[model samples]
Target: MTGSLQPVLAGVVTALVGFASSFTVVLAGLRAVGATDTQASSGLLAVCVLSGASAVWLGLRHRLPISIAWSTPGAALLVATGPVAGGWPAAVGAFVVSGLLIVAAGLFPPLSRAVAAIPKPIAAAMLAGVLLPLCTAPVRALVEVPALAGPVVLVWLLLHRYARRWAVPGALAVAVVAIALTAPPARPGSAGLWPVLDPTVPSLSLSALVGLAVPLFLVTMAAQNVPGMAVLTGYGYRPPFGSALRVTGLASAVAAPVGGHAVNLAAITAALAAGPDAHPDPDRRWIASVTAGVGLALLGLGAGVATTLVLLSPPVLIEAVAGLALVGALAGALAAALAEPDAREAAVVTFVVTAAGVSLLGVGGAFWGLLAGGLMLLLFRRPRPATAPAPEDGGTVAGAATPRQPGRRPGRRGVPAGR
Candidate 1:
């Protein structure tokens, strides 16, 4: 009984930490892409429930600690991309398309391989570029609203040094207190406390498909799903890649009309459930993930309240917490983007182009950054020279002078080659 309770508690912690740390980012992204307050709330509820459902299903079926989450990086990408040409409906359409693409990648080996074939440096560079602006929000918040943002930053710093896992949640708690003190009080029954689904009729557009859908898909795959598989594998679990993709993709599609962007496997938080900390016996760890799923679904009931608080708080204050949560991600992405010395130049170009936030022909910076980096790599790649034929029997060709030793020179004396 005690052993069973331990995983349940760990699962509770995982759910609370995961939701508190980055839900602000999700709301901000939906708002950025033209979702209204109500829509954003509904979107948040939808994703929490859907992702939790998927996690529970996968954990029970595979008996592995297969955690699932809404694509936080993909949300950041939406914030960076801003509003699409045809407004929120178009963005919804794009979400549907991205979900279908994920399904296709699972079903079609060639499509999955094609996405995987993208150069690592370029992919990491693009993600870093997308994340750069959001990661800077903490400092900006401090400068802009010192009293409100200072306490949040200070708590985050101190807790980060000691209880690293709880740093963001600690900051979020402070931010909430700060908001309650300064923000205007809500009237009785102003915000819904229950989960509600508000659906939109999706409208497709070429611009949204290219600018929003493609980048969203790429970011979710590279930043969330791929790393999630790695995390599970590191814990000695065989991740059901195809099934997971299909589940998440289908969930994303179903939830998009309700404003949820995307759902994928959890990367950072997966460690909490899959690691030994969740359970001493590896076989029983799936219980932690299952409990986490249920806990997350329960948390979805508070989406309306969370959205109300965000709506009332100073935008930068909420952004500061989200930004702090992403700083580690930005650092990891930047490190990966520059890891290969040979690809450094191309990677930098990708980073610069993406970070520029420029749009061309209705396509966003991410796609263009990849194109520019690929071009740079192709254009600058140097071919290896052909090896010279070996001399037969170690004999020199006719009229060829004897080769000098490395320490000997041509000037009739034993001189160093450098000299």
Candidate 2:
């Protein structure tokens, strides 16, 4: 019973963090991309439903801790992309394309391989740039609303230094308390329960396809799915990669017209369920993920309440909390980007160009950053020469004919003794 309880607790903890920690960023992203409050709520609910279901299904089917989640980076991409020429409807169309692309990639191993072929440094750098701005929310909010932001930052700093895992949620708690204590009470009727689906009839445009859809697909694939798989693999749990993509891709399409972006495998939250805290027996850990799914599904049904709390908060404060959540991720991405000497220059180029937020031909900086970085890699990457074959025990290089002894076989590394 104690053993069973541990996984259950871990699952609940993960779902709480998964839902509360980054939900604001998801809300902010939807709003930034022109979603109305109701539409945003609906979309959030939609994502929660799909992701939760996927988590449960995959976790149970494979007996692996296969947690699923919305692409926070993709949401960041949507935020950065802003509105499209055809507005929200066009953006929805782009989401559909991205969803289909993910589905297609799952169906075609070559496409998945191609996505995986993207250099790690460039991918890390691009992610860093996307997350960099969000991580600054705390600092920016400190200047704009010190009273509210100060306590939030202080809590985050303290928790980050000590508890680590609770840092973001703890800081968020502080922010909420600070707001409650300091801000004037909301006027009557300022908030209400509204969950309407303002469905968009998706319309495609060249600008949207190139600028939004393609970049969105790349961001979701490179930043979310690839690393996500790495996390799952790290946990000693392997699921069919193509199937996961298909599930998420189809889920994305289902959620798109309503408002949500994309759903994929969990990243930060994966560690919570995948690690030892979830269960001692790796075999039983699937229960943790399933538990997380059930919790998320319940939360999704109440997404309006979750979204409303965020809606009622000060935008800067929300940003600060969201940014605080991403600080660790941003730091990790930066370290990866600068780790390799051969990739450093290209990585830096990618980071700067992405951070600069430059757009060309309607496409966002992320695409351009990757393109520039890839080009830089071509010019700067040094090709390592083929390794020399090791000498055999017989004192000759591998595959070299050496002096033959009666019935003597090729020695170590397939080399015969003295020619």
Candidate 3:
């Protein structure tokens, strides 16, 4: 019973950590794109519900925590370019295009196979690169507001060293406590449950279609969905690609309007939920995602209340907690990406570039990190065959050693044995 209880606790913690870290970024992105209070909450709710449902559904079917989310890169692209072209409408259209591209990639096995073939180390490097900025945000905020951010940072460091698994929850608890200790009061506002229909209608514009839509599409496909699927596969789960894709696409289509821009597979957050510490069985860990989804939906439905809670914390406090929560995931990804032999070079390229935080032609560093690493692999490396040569014969060895073809047998070369 103690052993069983351990697994359950681990699973719950995994879900909590993954949910907390992933949602912070999503909320930040939504805010960056000008989502109103209700809209932002609703959009976050959509991410929670969809990500959890996908995780549960995939876990039940293939037994894995395949928690998905909106692509951070997509959001970065949106904030960088969506506003420049046509504002929210352009963002919505970009999401639609990106979702469709992801759907299309899932439907095409060749593309999936190609993405799957990328070296794991390189993927990890790219992931590390992409998440580095996110990880640093809290510290930067701390410099801005020490009174609130300082305590959270101190506790986070303590938990990270002594109670590794509790790191995220501990940091979050400290932030909540600090907020409770000293927060400015807020009065009731006119913002309510009203929905906006403006973002629902897609507007066709050359600037948005070329700049925002194209980059968003590419990022969702190469940077988000591809690595997400790899995380599931690495954990020995074969989630039905089509079902997950459809859910991500549908979620984005639904949320694109009212200021939600994009949703796809989560890489860093998904890793937190999919690893062994999450659950020993891996079959039941979907509970975490399920629970998170419910929480997210509630947050969306009660956007006002949720906003009140978020607003209660000093901005730096929230940022610090969010950054602290990601420390474990960042460490794990870096370790994994650097551990492999064949993937070392590719991974290094990815990590440095992604962490560089460069943006070019409306694309974020995440997308470019993957692109550069993949190109390096293609240009310099050959695929390592799964089997080696047979000892007696030159023929390749497979599942098991087979008798060499009569004519090709080493001992019988150039002549039939009995003739």
Q: Model 1: per-residue lDDT, tens digit, 67-127? A: 8999888888888888888999999999999999988877775675576667778888888
TM-score quality measure for candidate 3: 0.68
Clashes of 2: 6
| Alpha-carbon RMSD to native, per candidate | 14.0, 10.3, 10.7
Candidate 2 is scored at a TM of 0.88
- After superposition, the stretches of candidate 3 with alpha carbons farther than 4 Å from their true spots are 1-15, 56-66, 69-83, 116-129, 187-200, 204-236, 261-303, 328-419
Whole-model lDDT, candidate 1?
0.83
Best by TM-score: 1
Measured against the true structure, the TM-scores of the candidates, in listed sequence, are: 0.89, 0.88, 0.68
Ranking, lDDT, top scorer first: 1, 2, 3
Candidate lDDT values, in order: 0.83, 0.76, 0.57
- Tens digits of per-residue lDDT for model 2, 305-341: 6566676677889999988877766777787788888
Worst-scoring 10-residue span by lDDT in model 2? 392-401
Better of 2 and 3 by lDDT: 2
Cα shift from native, residue 179, model 2 (Å): 2.8
Q: Which candidate is the best by lDDT?
A: 1
For model 1, give the 10-residue run with minimal summed lDDT: 392-401
